[model samples]
Target: MTENTQHDVIRRNPLLEAAQEEMRKFERRENEFRRKDREERAAELQLPLAEIKVH
Candidate 1:
């Protein structure tokens, strides 16, 4: 194979895949915390619960 073709070959990386999965889980947890915090603050301010957005 030519040098460029050899360099362009795709490879599977288990470490990178695992890291990405962990990152997704971390983001989900962070979003949940932020949503809860927002809800608490809104309740304290007496704002309507419907006006608070979690998504």
Candidate 2:
């Protein structure tokens, strides 16, 4: 197959696009929850806010 045709095939892959979108959403929610959980734990332990990284 031609290189142009191969590129077109990859660009038109709906399944890959959908999976990537799902992962983006999942990561956003995961980070949000993780940050909240860390904040709660920090408050409980009286730890400084500078030590936790949710990203």
Q: Which candidate wins on lDDT?
A: 2
lDDT of each: 0.80, 0.89
Cα RMSD (Å) per model? Answer: 3.7, 4.0
Best by TM-score: 1
Candidate 1 is scored at a TM of 0.69
Worst 10 residues of 2 by lDDT: 46-55
Q: For candidate 1, which ten residues in a row score worst on lDDT?
A: 6-15
Q: Can you list the residue pairs that collide in candidate 1?
A: none
TM-score of 2: 0.66
On residues 1-55, what C-alpha lDDT tens digit does candidate 1 reach at each position? 6876755543346667888999999999999999899889988998898965645
